[model samples]
Target: MEALNLTSSGPTTFILNGIPGLEAAHIWISIPFSVFYIISLLGNFTVLFVVAKEQTLHKPMYLLLCMLALTDIGTSTCIMPKALCMLWFGSKYITVDGCLTQMFFIYMIAIMHSAVLVTMGFDRYVAICDPLRYATILTNARIAKLGLVGLIRAVLLVLPLPLLLRRLPFCANRVIPQTYCEHMALVKMSCGDTIMNRMYGLVLTFVIMGSDLTLIGLFYGLIIRAVLRISSKKAHQKALNTCSAHICVMVITCATSLFPALTNRFGQGIAAHVHTLLANLYLLVPPMLNPIIYGVKTKELRDKVGKYTCRM
Candidate 1:
């Protein structure tokens, strides 16, 4: 039976890898990564600013967009700056407490991102499936409640991760083979039996992301059915267009997150640096693309951004 390798003193520090096999290219790699980081920061911030400043965007959908933008900013901030510093300055040492804190916020924002996506899906469902009651159902007070519930849910789910990780003993190598401190990466470094940690992570991913994806799919199904019932072609087109931005975000997020994770868990032949790159992309791409997607696909948002920019 596997047992906890308890010790009086736990690991004090961990060294993070910039990229598994790309140390020589860290400077070159930092260029694109830096661009993505800067764009993600500016994009997400712009989305939040536009949504907040524009009174016309005070609806539930835009409010959820604000939540997503905030989550993206939080998620990107947790990963990018540290990774950039590691690449740029060769500062790779992170204390155990700092590692755990980074893990906490990364997982927290990720869960919050999923929750926000689900809420956006729900907003779409209400908007399309029952257009008449959309206003009443997704009121500002109710959206606020939903946002609070999402925050609580994300907090509750991710709360155990760092705590559980703190209990494990690290007798093996303390170097994490990634740019950032991932929960699983930390767990993999522990000499102690980490079945519980691994199982909890797997279960959490399945329960939270699985359920959110299912709910989004179901909502879209209902939405499609509702759209099909519409008689006019223009009305049908309009209904679908409303959902295009959310669908794009949903696809990008799920693809960026799920594929790399599945490959990491199951792909035995995949390169370590490939996993690292994927993990970085999973965190980076959505935040980078989300604002552009919304700006292009969402006319109201585009118009608001245009007006906001023109006034400047």
Candidate 2:
């Protein structure tokens, strides 16, 4: 990775390849990206509306679902439109400031997603293990506080990245080989020494994502134990059923994120186009699938969705 001399006096604009190593497929590629974006927006918005309108969904569990839906929307929205434009219109140039902003929101939403999932696990644990105290422990105010904490945590952690990047002299290639302005992608283009930048980003990701995963696992472990202790099969099944939708979402979210991160880092034999597709899917799949999963798996949500769709 040889560094090039700075070509201009001002900040540079990087050319984003809509689908690197697959330029000829950009037009056709935009079709699916557009479809996914539309579906994600509609699906997440519907979840928000449904959760808001249905009084039965005002409880902590459903409220957490609502938060997860919102996080999905934010995550997908940050990248999809630019990616669509690049695929369809050849609008691949992104300014440094704009790119940093996109990168910030992208990581911020991802962190919020982990936070929401962890909180959802807590909601489930309380509902199952301490049913008598669930309501008292997770009130509306506490949920709001959780959201605030997630936001603050992400902001505090990710805020330094763009600032640190901005301070670096990017006297190198101004071309990024992906559809979006990811932190690592942009860092790879810099001419200046980025040991600190790289190390901090990796450390932050491990700390936040790692802690969230551990907490989620612990909560689910407790939930599982509590469910198994139930004397009747029916009660055990009922408790597990209550947790199924959330478990599905957590699996999907973690799988999508982990696959790309691991593949990019270690799977050198994988095709670049495949990596790009996975990167795109990381943003698209969750938003599009989450509402569908909840709508199909949860009877109450399914009934409400069916009624709402029929009414509309």
Candidate 3:
């Protein structure tokens, strides 16, 4: 589908309205983003490689990690290539269809990432909360099923967004201010009121992100309660350590998703941009850091990665 020409005022135009004092900001942003992109790619690839090669790490936890790496890689690949292209090539004019497609995949992956995090939380809870039944509850077949369900869910949840946009009469401006076509941002550009789009988006936010966060909170809370009752210091410490990486990931994801909306509501453009940068970081930084977090904390992954790399 062609990009919706909704701009009522005229044909959508993307003029670079240069921000004062931010002349060098693009350069600064590009440097860090480039570094983050490289790290994210390398780190996730390493995780994927190690998990694929090491038979010992073929358990549920590592399987979930492989999924996480795959999602992270998908996320960075979605945003970074276009972003870097804009920075290096000075090409920011995306067609309406291209913009919609970008939004679709980005939203799909983001929702899927959240779902995967929730699944990981559940996996941890089962391992800690019901160790005796963990194996039976999270079997290889079950994990495969859960993963397939997550994939379908993400696609289903985000697919309708573009269709909804396609239904809207494009009477006005086509130029999106941001580098990427965010759903809400595009909706805002509509000449006609977008009450239905907003309502749908709110419902989606509650269902996908809100539900995932609630489940993650419950899982962590239960884990905390379980850990407190354990008498052995080492046992409690080990349980907490297992959760550290997930907790960091959760915090980053939540901040990235929630903060921008809040800042935008308050009319803070700079804050919104900062939030955008943080949102990108949630995809890039956490993925890059995940390997380090797991490797430093888990002796098994660390040893395996070192041995595996040394052999090469």
Candidate 4:
């Protein structure tokens, strides 16, 4: 309910340091980043297209996969282009408004990604534990509402961040030591009392993401217990296989995302370039890997992709 609408003694333009000590390798670095970006685009778009064309894939699980593809697209697109621009062309300056807008979308997608994973976890839990009610419980309307709630949660929580920054007086040290505008990075730039900013950001991130991951783990724990109760070994194997891909994705996304945040906040002995590099990789890994994991693991989607590829 509080608002910080006044702009303070902060610089209107902020400089994004692409990499602290690797300016020369910036061009070389662009190569791999570009590859990851292209792969993410192709892979995610393929999933969206395949899901759209195949009517039989219109169930809750596949609908959730489409949501994952969209968020994956968002996650990479939000970070990669700005980073690539800084790397390739040395265009590292961002306006305060520009910086704030970028921060909103980046963190929004990050939150939504966690929510989608949580929803997917719920979907699996229902499918594994309450198979008879899976369809009835997760109708199209329910899925849409869940996605909408995630969007609303992300927006309401992240909206205050930029507004909070507006109230702070940033010193003349306007160089942000990364390729993109991150919340803590921007907060650290301020010379004013930013206890509120730090507290809000920490709570927003740790609470939302931490709870999502915990729910995912809990979902799997229940799923594993249910599978064990099955008398047939073959049935247990089938159930485990169904969850393997989603769990693998959660592990990859969870580690890559959390580690960089940890490195950003508390990695005192860590080098500046290490933080920058990890942040860049953090943005790239999940998008590039998600569709591939699903494509390999989900048989129906895999078959559709294979048939589409063969026709191509």
Candidate 5:
């Protein structure tokens, strides 16, 4: 049915690759992927639920944690089902419209994920540098507006990508060597020159992610400066402890996301299947680990989770 719809006159469809030359092992591969996906869902959902249940946890940091969980869910949702379908059911076709829709969400989620991290960094900064003003600075309404701004930014930046991609005519090659509709993979399927598309993707990624990372770094720098000035050794250790979890999360997420993009663009000698696997890792790792890191590192959230579990 999908193959029948690849004509230029109507709509275009492309076949998704699970792994080149590893068709026989797709089912085997699905086992671990599915497990990771399930664990991520359970973990992130627990975060959302606990945050909602505990009134005391209704602070700026926890609210931002909720945003992180939401983005994690979004990242996984955009990739996992289609990936699992391709792996398990041997269904691997994505219509042009469907592919574009998926691409938009994937890009938006990534940008928003970065935004949430930066916002969390800001939360930490305010808490440390201006503890008395933290409440007034990051009010509930202000937090909501900050999230809305991030959403708007993500939409405006990602909106052009799908529009730019639509102008490319399919060159009769409908096979994309990845489970999901990655931008470069889709760009390669076009008959036209993809240099501009590649350039736009590269520039936007650097400008937005680069800007976010810079702001986050600046926030941490100020936070550290403030922390070091504190006379009490106990206060110094406490402040550093508060930031350690956020730093760990930031490092894990940024590395997983940026490395695959960089490697995809520059690492020509690498294998295609390896790139695909890395892309999947980019989507999976942040969602799977963020909750665990927070739960282990933050005592309040951890205690709430333990009590909630005992009751259940």
Candidate 6:
């Protein structure tokens, strides 16, 4: 069994504080979480299947949509199984290696999801801003290459984290305060100094996610400008409507992720937990809601899903 090594001289035991006035909180959350998990799984699977089955969706946009669905499935799978276990069994203690492994996959998928969003932004930019060159710019070969590059970058960026965690000399406190194996939370339990881990984390965040966010913002800015220059009122409305879903996703993700990091740095535990909950929501909510959003917002996907489901 994997165990966290604590640095203290005496025997160590872990105790978790049961929440006051929220004895049923776990039960309450479980109901919606279970529902969302089912919906998210089915919805994302349908997306993957529809994209694979339909030759028409072989284009760049649908390819990115498929990638997004895959990432969503991955992200939720990493967290929900353990989360549900915690809810049902009231067991939150995770072994050291297990925690590190969980952290690795969670961060990997989260970063990859962000990278895919940047790719999606570029897809929209080319489709809208450079309509004349969209086909040439985002060809099948190019899309495939982009996917490969995203996968490579995600792996490379997260590779160091687990190695770094393993190198740390953990002193006695093996118990993680949070339900899930969050990277910073694990580091916090360490009795030794975690300056290196913190520094590495900061570098990874800014280098990968920060850069991607900047590029995505730039792409959308150009897209908005291009949209504004259009002469027809109906065309402008259509363009804005198409952009809204992605914009909402971007805002939700960034706010959830960035806020927690900030609050943690400021040593605000309650604020950090709230942000963590929001971040978890940001991760799950989009996956659950994306299909619904796209279905209601985009006539093509909605019609396709409806027809496909009806046939089934």
In Å, residue 153's CA in model 6 sits off its true spot by: 0.9
Query: Cα lDDT of model 5 overall?
Result: 0.89
Candidate 6 CA-lDDT value: 0.75
Candidate 2 structure quality by residue, lDDT tens digits, 1-312: 555433357455888986778999899988888888899889889989998999988877788888888998999899988988888889999987788899999998899889999998998899899989987999988998998999899898889998888767675568888999887777777878899898888888779878999999999999988887889999988999889988999899888998988787678899988988999899999889998888888898889889999997
lDDT of 2 at 105: 94
lDDT of 4 at 305: 97
For each candidate in the order shown, give its overall lDDT on alpha carbons: 0.89, 0.86, 0.76, 0.89, 0.89, 0.75
**TM-score list, all predictions:** 0.96, 0.95, 0.89, 0.96, 0.96, 0.88
Of the pair 2 and 6, which is ahead by lDDT? 2
Over 79-185, each residue of candidate 1 has an lDDT whose tens digit, in order, gives 88889889999999998788889999999899989989998999999998888998889998898898999899999999999889878877647789999899888
lDDT of 3: 0.76
Model 4, position 106: C-alpha lDDT score: 92
Predictions: Cα RMSD each:
2.1, 1.9, 3.5, 3.1, 2.4, 3.6
Which pairs of residues collide in model 3? Answer: 3-96, 3-97, 6-170, 6-172, 7-171, 7-172, 7-173, 8-171, 8-172, 8-173
TM-score of 3: 0.89
Any idea what lDDT model 1 has?
0.89
Q: Residue by residue across 2-88, what tens digits does model 6's lDDT show?
A: 334532532243322122234468777767777888898998898888878888878888888888888889988887887777777
lDDT of 3 by residue, 1-312 (tens): 243453453344442212223435876677888998898888889888998998888898888888888888888888788777776666767766677788898889888888789999999999888999999899867877888899999999899899888767654455455556678777766766678888888789778877888999999999999999999999998898888888877776677667665554455556445645655665567666766776776678889899978988
Regions of model 6 farther than 4 Å from truth:
1-24, 267-276
In model 4, the Cα lDDT at residue 74 comes to 94
Q: Lowest lDDT 10-mer window, candidate 5?
A: 1-10
Better of 5 and 6 by TM-score: 5
Candidate 5 residue lDDT tens string, 202-238: 9998999889999999999999889879999999999
